[model samples]
Target: MGKGGGQVHMGNKAFSSHSPSPPRNNSGGRGLGGGGMDRWTGVIHVPLSGGGPTFRVAASLIFSPAKTLAVPRANAILFTGDRVRGSGEPAIERLSDAAYLAGLLARKLAGEANAWVVDAACFSRSLAVYRELVPSVDAVGDPRRYDPTGFPASAGVANILAHCVHEIQSTITGTTMKDSAGIQDPNASMLSSCPPRTIILGFSKGGVVVNQLVTELACLESEPTPALSTHNLLVPVSASDVLSSISEFHYVDVGLNCAGAYISDHAVIKGIINYVLHTSKNLRFILHGTPRQWSDPNRPWIGMEKDKMLNLLQDGAQKCEGRLVLSEKRYFDGKPGSLLMHFEILQVMDIS
Candidate 1:
């Protein structure tokens, strides 16, 4: 119940002050610096339209009281999903569904306001489908070329998340404006001219993506970087600079299959928890799952079975230093099964 609210800003001076050592080789591919095959790359295909959106069932809806909270003008909402939904096929459909959900949140935050939505999934099939569904939204990196689905191993997830932060920063700082026209504008044009109060929303595997992005941003802010050639193009931006710009990070987990032996791997959970603890204090983590036997009582696994996942999340929230909100468990009793719960995660976001 740590409801205390405080402001954490990433200053430019801080960015100019320190430097981090080069990334060490990942040996077992588990540690932040280790090199283990990223588990996120494993793909599982799920039919989209048939399952119903998962967010509606798995997510805890927050009705903002007083119409608005005194929150940062510029916010970033990052969403990540479980592994089964991270594959090329399902990733595409899930993103498309999530876009709609994001749109809904945008409207709630700023009525009829169009916010810049970035589909950062790393499956070519998913990216293609996302583009077809919401062509106007700006997407960072090619899903096919960029493997976002593989992560929590060898910093693969962290790297993709960094890229996402960079992409958002570019749009906010007017860097993307120089790229070309037809870039979907969050406010008026596809390419956002002004830095917007941003929010990142991810589901399933997307949750891992958001976590790494936040961690990198925080780490970057702590260590400043030197000015490099912005002229080379393709050159990675200084990590410190990117981290300094982020104001807030929000992570939402929907219908997570955290109970599975393969899914509950220690490395994956530890990476996520470590990133959350070390990142900025201006963070909020929300988890939605079931309360069934699927959840491992001995571990911090969150799954959808009976409200067990939600209960575990509540427990985690208690130990967390930042604001933690747990949603009331809502079961998806459809004959088709809980698959709809997976799809609904995207459906609730109102992208279109």
Candidate 2:
């Protein structure tokens, strides 16, 4: 597979002056294939002015702002933690993590910093977690009664992340888009709203969740209304009616190591790539990971070939015409794990 590139126009404009060009075709030493994939690539260099050690990561996208899509005023971001991390825990833990992610999003949008941090591991068994994450923000539905396993399915997980994005953006900009109808039905409303140029970061189970959501959202883009029902009770809804309202969709997949054993299937990755390639061509997908185990290597956290995983990503980019940018590789020795890498990638400034 080779990277494919073509022109994209944002809104009704003839050309976009803001889109960054794709990265140069460097396939010899790098894992990428020799054929130049039609994709935009760039390096987001954020110097850590203060705080911990400074680090840099490369980023890639499909659209060139210079050719298409007007640069929006603000960039909305959504971050979802790993399954075990996102589940089970004190309410405060979850809120603290959300707050941290919000802080990172704020900093990135303001261009005041390079990275931000969010603890996705905090899990909450009760609704109290919602209170801590957003004291002023109210859940569209009852968190106490809500079952993470029900409704939206794994794909709906992206809706949760999307909801977080809406809340954070609203809190920072005081915008009303968050209150739109899609809050109730993200699958439908997601594509209708044409969400702001947004970046969604998901880990472990969260990655699968986001993948499902993106796939569904892409389907909604064309069909808008699918005769698909959830739990055979919710009834199929019109995605076009809902998703058309949003602007942009940028997906970032981190903690690839935590993806567990199931996601290693090439079919799973290819499914995601095909969806992005055919449906949301403008979307940006990023995969972040390390070669170390979550716990001790002797114990073997999850059986995954680091080389194979990286190759899968490279293949996905080539097959889907999307750029795959790798972050600095970190090794985990038997010691306390540092949040520095997470902070560097997700850290944000106090824009408010």
Candidate 3:
């Protein structure tokens, strides 16, 4: 991507953002949607770096900052794991493929200057039994693991195209705030031209991916080598590229009634602790939760698990020489749990 301008690319081709969203169709997953904003929607078959199974997932993108982006131009990039939805288009429409709700969140947080937003839907969807993707089901329909491997490749690029808007700008070093929920600070002098970092977030059932990714990071000594490789809509991306680019890993109101929602295995947390403390780059973990998921009677353990994960990450951060920072934000506190509050957090999570 060139500075001051970038082009929209998908599947060995680049398109102009000067036009409105393309006509919608069921079979073709590539197109644009929402208020004439440059957007792309499609299905990508993402591979697992650890070599288990490829995810047949749907993804959506909102290009900001004068359009057209390529690898290495990102100010910041956000990978979002969507919450559960009902069957049919109504529910899933807001997620990875439909690109409605996720797009809204992108517009609110990443906007046109802060970071590029890649909101992902599950490879498959059904209902409360399970809503979002990431936790691939087993032969008997039980979730197996939460792996955020090679996801950028699934978004149609060897590296994801990025664009973001913060109050004005943001970098890891500079200081800025978009809202009460988050802050931005990119060094205009030192990092204005440097490649932006990454932020990975999982909401609701989608949070499972966040849990899995942190645990997996502990297991990585180097870049992830793929056992299988395939690309169609976008360029192929290496697992290491996605992994190394990450700076902030966020678990946003994630709870799916599945094992390891906030990491059930303590050993996995310990491994992450060691990995972050020893890593060269700085890493931060942010947890944004609401009373809806935390105080549910049906799932009372939700809050406890969230706290457990937060405490473990805090412990890890404390052990490191400020190389790793752990932070948490609780929204709608004291407010009774409600579905409105559950979905509302997406638009204003305040990921500064």
RMSD vs true structure, all candidates: 18.5, 16.8, 11.4
For model 3, how does the per-residue alpha-carbon lDDT over 1-352 read when each residue is reduced to its tens digit? 1122211223112221224444233322233434554544333333322232333333344433433222222223344444345534432333333234433444544433223344442333442222233336453223576554534232222322211222112221134433311222222122123334546776675565465566556666544455323111111233444455567777777765655567756677787777776667788787888888888888877777778877777776778888888778889999998766776676568776
Clashes of 1: 72
Please give, for residues 180-243, the per-residue lDDT of candidate 2 as tens digits.
2233322221212222333444433233333434444444423434432221111112233223
Q: Please estimate how well model 1 matches the true structure, expressed as its whole-model Cα lDDT.
A: 0.31
Judged by whole-model lDDT over C-alpha atoms, candidate 3 comes out at: 0.48
Query: How far is 39's C-alpha from truth in model 3 (Å)?
Result: 7.1
Per-candidate local distance difference test? 0.31, 0.31, 0.48
Model 1 is weakest, by summed lDDT over 10 consecutive residues, at: 33-42
Model 1: what TM-score? 0.38
- Model 3 spans > 4 angstroms off: 1-67, 71-98, 109-125, 128-136, 139-196, 222-236
- Residues 202-249 of candidate 1: C-alpha lDDT, one tens digit per residue: 554454444444434434323444553222121123333233333343
Ranking by TM-score: 3, 2, 1
Query: Under the 3 Å rule for N, CA and C atoms, how many clashes does model 2 have?
Result: 50
- Residue 250 error for model 3, in Å? 1.4
